[model samples]
Target chain A: MTDDLPPLLLGRLNHVGIACPSIDDTIAMYARLFGATVSTPPFDLPAQGVRVAFIDVANSQLELIEPLGPDSPIHGFLKKNPAGGQHHVCFEVADIIAARDAMRARGATVLGSGEPRIGAHGVPIIFVHPRDTGGVLIELMATPDHY
Target chain B: MTDDLPPLLLGRLNHVGIACPSIDDTIAMYARLFGATVSTPPFDLPAQGVRVAFIDVANSQLELIEPLGPDSPIHGFLKKNPAGGQHHVCFEVADIIAARDAMRARGATVLGSGEPRIGAHGVPIIFVHPRDTGGVLIELMATPDHY
Candidate 1:
């Protein structure tokens, strides 16, 4: 927004995160309905406290994540929604640190520890507070295979 | 899910729909944060009872829709959510009817008259009941232009 700083190197929408109650059921539903391809099989990411899978779409992908343990954000979301729905939208950025700093300068809050963490896809990412982004949690992922 | 039917012609993820209270504010937020470009200008689609705009992304787009009239679906969404959030994920399909029929045969409910309606993007689109799609409102958009 400001002329002083350069634009953030934003790439494509990498994937849309869908909070799923059962990755198995979700995979079955999409596969049966749309013949969706599963690029990533279901596996537990203990660090993120979620079991995750990726549904390959033509352009981007859909990430299905279920809470693995208590106190996980996905668990909190499912408890609030119960029906499971879109959780967050992850967009690729060329430089993670630059995007983070630029967003902060523009008054956006980076969630968690404000440091890049290994995301569900094994790429470094940071979550921008939903409060700052029209009440939608947005994850900025570093592309071209992270630093 | 049935193998008798040929696979539905699913295309790329076309756009993700985001309900907005004010298109102006939404555009401003994305621009200031990520230098996001506006692909489609704000325009009122009275037929759909909504005001719509498209934000450009590398691979796809974000459709920002606000309630134009009181009974608009976006109006109901805003009322239910209040803070606004991701409303639906739209995927491009080569053939709309075949896709709809495939879903119906598989026990998925197609919203409205079970016919493709002109969507916010002026393309033929239909909504599959969230109940059938893992609680996420899914929009199947006809691509390569429509009939």
Candidate 2:
């Protein structure tokens, strides 16, 4: 059954999201240490309740997500540790809808299994529950340029 | 100043380490969805106080690490969240020594820079602190069979 599947949605890693208490400090640290360049500047996502900034570190990207308001996911994460930390890893998919469907067939649950929503980097994205992927919060993304 | 360095490290993602409460479930989830076969079976790392298994998921890998003893890193992480989750992401490099040196030059504190320790796949690896990489745990690795 598994052999018949097109492929696993474990696609290329788009970026690793870092939850930070202060996006400015986080950006500075990565810039100084890894010489990471800001590929995507800070932008707000009211729907997701956060602002994000991305720095390209060689092959992978380093993303800094900070909650704008108290209701944001970052807000909840910060309560545990103000420093905030690693958020979720994003994987580039050929088709997010198809990926979600494939994952469901394998006993995985997804937050949104239909159309992709605009996420950081102007890409269509969907979130898969961590419970379904070994408790690792996974984001499936499909960049228009790639598609 | 950022452009002075001769591309500090060779660019490619190595793997993402996931701390799972149930290695069996994690293994099944990945294998069923991604066609990810077990590249390395579960093995106990008494020194690190953890048991680990590895699977190659496309160009990258999915590693399942579980706590075997109380002193293990997995144990501490699991205590924080019993559900288990994404642990760390490793970056592949051509030369570990050169990469470590570059990181140090950039003010990054390496966990074990001088010596490269053998990982689950028998590859040499070193960990970089989250404090230095924008609050994201980073690992640098080199495998003889990789390049």
Assess every candidate by TM-score. Answer: 0.94, 0.82
**What lDDT does each candidate get?**
0.85, 0.73
Off by over 4 Å in 1: A1-8, B1-9, B145-147
In order, what fnat does every candidate score?
Answer: 0.60, 0.49
- lDDT by residue (A16-75, candidate 2, tens digit) is 787988887776665565555567778888877898887765557767898888788778
User: Could you tell me the TM-score of candidate 2?
Assistant: 0.82
- For candidate 1, give the DockQ: 0.60
Model number with the top lDDT: 1
* Residue pairs with backbone overlap in model 1: none
Positional deviation of residue A102's Cα in model 2 after best superposition, in angstroms: 4.1
